[model samples]
Target: MKQPKGVFVTGIGTEVGKTVTAALLVRTLKADYWKPVQSGDLNHTDTMKVRKWAGEAAGTFHPERYRLNLPMSPHASAADDGVTIQLQDFELPDTRNFLIVEGAGGLHVPLNDQDCIIDLIQRLGLPVVLVSRHYLGSINHTLLSVEALRHRGISIAGLIFNGDPHPSTESIIEKMTGLQPLFQLGEMQALNDECFERQVQRVGQACKTLLDGL
Candidate 1:
């Protein structure tokens, strides 16, 4: 079977469940996972988490292009690590199955002096799955996020709400952006492969066609 275009996983903001959603997608589609630029936390990186859960999913976990040392923005961390990030530095992994590329931070997050996550998305030509968690000002953050991607003509695969549902917030974003929600992952006390696989059963059916079409 021919491989489908990868899904680029991004979030409305930092600490908003991008990695969790990406891991679920990776397992759901049995897709390869890649996080291009890791700013820090190499000990427990997103790639590590995906590798841990994607174990029999046959998902290949690709290493980051830049493994910066400090837990800071890619730009600062790169500088601290004495390395410069360039657009030419990133290369998409070769895989026959679906691919799930998780972005760092938000759309505007800087990889270097000039390039940001949005730019990298454009460069990679991957569709996005924007993960949004409900917060006090999340409506604004989510809207602005949708606008940024739309403004750049990026394909938004869908939105995935990661915490307790806030219908009002979710509704407005969907209503305003006309972007569908693939799944609403509720808060769970324990997070593991078993838990993620359970969520996949609920979300996989909904997201499969959309991701395959990408």
Candidate 2:
């Protein structure tokens, strides 16, 4: 069987809007969404959020491999639940449509004593859509993230900034990494389906070439 075409959605740090970014990607591509390891907030998991945000048009929302209950790092959360998250436990859901696999946190997020989030990404062999929201030191975080991915021989599909555009910060990152952001999503006041649909079109249009390449 042919492997699914997909992109790994990860962030420089937590709460950098990786879920929103992944949902937008799903809407744009009509891809299947999966979160291999859900650390906490099982009541409202990332899979649920993406499905609600993008609506049915976004495609399927797959169940997580491990849904730990505590709202903490996967390693700690799994330990709290008396579970050891072995990567072998994960299996990519059968899908022909493009897939959007959202990661728990940054590349350094630990899944087990020896495996971090990046290791899972590497194992899956999927290119990444690295989300970097503008913050005080986001430029450094963003660059370092790209460098780390490069060091691991993982392909970065593209950068997708999730907050206000900081031209100075963005420009430096571009110059240093030579990777222009595929698209930048600003904060939304009213995050409704219609609003998210508009964002899907906007990012879809602006990043058409990038998406095409992917």
Candidate 3:
């Protein structure tokens, strides 16, 4: 299989497991990881989490461009920090290795007054690997996410279903989007090297397919 290219990792909404999915991709593809704008949790940011869980298979763990103190939306958090996030403030880390960029929240998440996460994804020019988890409104959220990305003419690497499987929910998403189902990951009770390795084995092939297609 060809080396999978880098991808932007986004989700249906916040707390939908974008970091975990990004770590999984990092382990599966042996790729570098980046979270450009970390709203909060400076001590243990998403970059650190991916590094911890992804283990040695991961390449480089790039630092965040904007590290806000509050755990809120980028715009709100940046306001508290006395910083204004500009679209030009971000630049892709210089790397030859495959990169897994984990976005702060959903595609519509606002980074500043003029731009949102989707705008940043567009600026980065990487295909998205959308992370979706089964929940009450996930179907609507997932479909809307797909629609938004498609409308922007951004390429999507594939869809990743995280957390417990709801076959019926998963089916409709697939049926409606006709998106390539990369893999499904169960909730990780433990975040450790052992757990990451086991999950990597489960989705390794699909990760390769994602890379090859990209």
lDDT of each: 0.85, 0.88, 0.90
Rank the models by lDDT, top first. 3, 2, 1
On lDDT, the candidate that comes out on top is 3
Worst 10 residues of 2 by lDDT: 202-211
Q: List the residue pairs that clash in candidate 1.
A: none
Candidate 1's C-alpha runs over 4 A off are: 1-4
With candidate 3 superimposed using the best TM-score fit, by how many Å does residue 81's alpha carbon deviate from the native?
0.8
User: Candidate 2 has which clashing residue pairs, if any?
Assistant: none
Q: 25-112 in candidate 3: lDDT tens per residue?
A: 8988889998999998999888888888888878998888999999999999999999999999888888889999999889999998
Residues 1-214, candidate 2: write the lDDT tens digits. 5667888999999999999888888887888999999888889888888998878778888988998999999999999999999887876778988899999989999999999999999888889989998899898899889999999999998888888878998899989999988888998777679889889778777656666887
Question: Model 3: residues >4 Å from true position, as ranges?
Answer: 1-4
Relative to the unseen true structure, what is the Cα RMSD of model 3? 2.6
Q: What is the lDDT of candidate 3?
A: 0.90
* TM-score quality measure for candidate 3: 0.96
Give each model a TM-score.
Answer: 0.95, 0.96, 0.96
Give the Å error, residue 101, model 2: 0.3
Q: Give the clash total for candidate 1.
A: 0
- Residue 54 local lDDT, model 1: 62
